[model samples]
Target: MILIANGNASRIGIHTSIGDFAATKDGKTYGPLNTDGAFYNMKMLMFDTKSRPIGILVMEIPATSATSEADAARQAEALRKEVSEKIPDLEWLFQHS
Candidate 1:
């Protein structure tokens, strides 16, 4: 089972690979879309509850070709929709698998 999640630097640390990261309510870190405005898969380091490196969390970056304000908005909305739809199934895997 594949569990989907966002990659970001948590409060205690920072990810050196990518910029524009932020902490989310889900206890995960998220990075901004690349300058190319394309969704890229990232293998992020994950820590267990004890702060040990358990494994890597692979995440999907948002798909965006933001050339202008409207384009960015549309792509962001599309990405949001996609993430929302997949979250339920992914969450199940995260908890069960």
Candidate 2:
């Protein structure tokens, strides 16, 4: 499971249903044809309460590409700090996680 959030709200669930073959947003499915540089590539799948795809949340950092686990942890902490300052609701989430 994954958590997607911002200053306003947050959602948690399996990020995707179809692997990387496609993505869904605002009740619409997007294919590779919708590529727009980092915009499309950075999105994490978001789903509604019924477990249906709703949209996406663009990730701040692609930690998967980090050189090592330590690097990923550092990037995650930095991102948590950056996000918590802007969205206080997520502060606890970061701490508990």
Candidate 3:
């Protein structure tokens, strides 16, 4: 998935693997779904373990702004930590993107 941070120049973008199929956060399943339509309406994205690893690009808009380069780096670190805590096994490749 591709996550684009919305805000100031301090924002960032993240590209990661979707890792599988789609399902609602409440466990309601969607299509073996490609094309984003099945997953677009979701507030939080989740995937089914039954499917093969795949990329489903997504963008996350946060409510905060980082005013400086250092602040941006700190914010990015916090975001990474949050994601790691949520999906410990998932791999993340970070860059200026």
Candidate 4:
């Protein structure tokens, strides 16, 4: 849901056709979500697809001063749990670098 880039800045363009994003689990699907009016004011970090365990869109978000990589990792872990629970055989990956 939220990701932070591990390196330099770069704008990841969200186009009309972001290509094929697959879902590891049956009946499970995902798309590029809208961050237009998000209070967090985060940007699109990375785009991951569900061709494997990684569901495709891995967004890197800036964390609060108190936030740590562990926190981000926990968030990612939680997301994995939620998705896998509902999707059955879902896969995901986070690529900040």
Tens-digit per-residue lDDT, 1-97, candidate 4: 2222224345333331233333312423322223552222121122233323433434343454215445554555455455445443323233224
lDDT of 3 by residue, 30-97 (tens): 22222542222212232223232223323332323534434444454444345545542324333334
Q: What TM-score goes with each of the models?
A: 0.31, 0.29, 0.28, 0.31
lDDT of each: 0.42, 0.40, 0.35, 0.35
Q: In candidate 2, which residue pairs clash?
A: 26-54
- Least accurate stretch of 10 residues (summed lDDT) in model 4? 38-47
Per-residue accuracy of model 2 over 28-92 as CA lDDT, tens digit each: 32222123322223333444334443344344334335554345445544543454455434233
Error of 3 at 8 (Å): 18
Clashes of 3: 1
Error of 1 at 74 (Å): 0.5
Worst 10 residues of 3 by lDDT: 39-48
lDDT of 3 at 41: 20
**How much does candidate 4 score in TM-score?**
0.31
- Quote the positional error of residue 91 for candidate 4 in Å: 12
Please identify model 2 stretches exceeding 4 Å from their true place: 1-64, 89-97
